[model samples]
Target: MRYVVQVFASAFRIRKIVNDGEFCILYSDSDPSIDCIYVTDKWILSNQAKPGGYYIAYDNGDSEYVEEDEFKMRATFVDQD
Candidate 1:
């Protein structure tokens, strides 16, 4: 698995993990006033995540699985793999 970590000129940053051509939002916090997006393999619910899709964890303990297309739109791929 490959990973890309992006840091912006802000109080937070975004980190992503790529596994087998799949992209997941590991962590992201662009605004300090809002809750950050934090998700990992352990946070994925049973059978909730699909192939090419990943979960996004919230501060309230909520999570949502988004598809690959959405991930691409939300994230910026810096390099080719």
Candidate 2:
């Protein structure tokens, strides 16, 4: 299974997600047609460096807005199995 996590930005900017294990941060700035990032893993960690930044989690092909605090907490449990 794969996952995609995105950090919300007001302007057209690149957001990065930390690669905890099998997942790696992906930047899609090459096309310029679309601005986004992709990830492949069970869980994704959002960029906690920026506070108040909106975060979205995509799992099982579904996306939803996630809280920053909750996002960080989830990242800790990755790769436990």
Candidate 3:
């Protein structure tokens, strides 16, 4: 069996698994119109800390800024059971 990993960037972006692990590493992108953040696959969970990076996976690749909100953007690494 095969499993695909994904990264939910924001509201408009979803990146595929470029790397694998509890600490996945992916590319990061940014837009210049909205008050948003760009993230990369390179990430870690709250309890864990890896490298620092981000990507604008969603948001139509535009700079349409909006109020700050929180979403449970998460990633995990473990041998499937």
lDDT of 1 by residue, 4-74 (tens): 96433222233343343233333433334434343455544543554446444445555566666766666
Residue 65 error, candidate 2, Å: 0.9
Q: Which runs of model 3 end up more than 4 angstroms from their true locations?
A: 1-17, 31-43, 47-81
Q: Could you tell me how far off, in angstroms, the CA of residue 38 lies in candidate 1 after the best superposition?
A: 15
Question: What is the clash tally of candidate 1?
Answer: 0
TM-score of each: 0.32, 0.27, 0.18
For residue 31, give model 1's deviation from the true position in Å: 22
Superposed Cα deviation of residue 40, candidate 3 (Å)? 12
For all candidates in order, the CA lDDT equals 0.45, 0.42, 0.32
lDDT of 2 by residue, 1-81 (tens): 999986432221224545656655544322354455445544343333222333343444544334456556554332211
Query: Among all windows of ten consecutive residues in candidate 2, which has the lowest summed lDDT?
Result: 7-16
lDDT of 3 by residue, 12-52 (tens): 22222244433344332222344423333333333132223
Per-model clash counts, in order, read 0, 0, 16
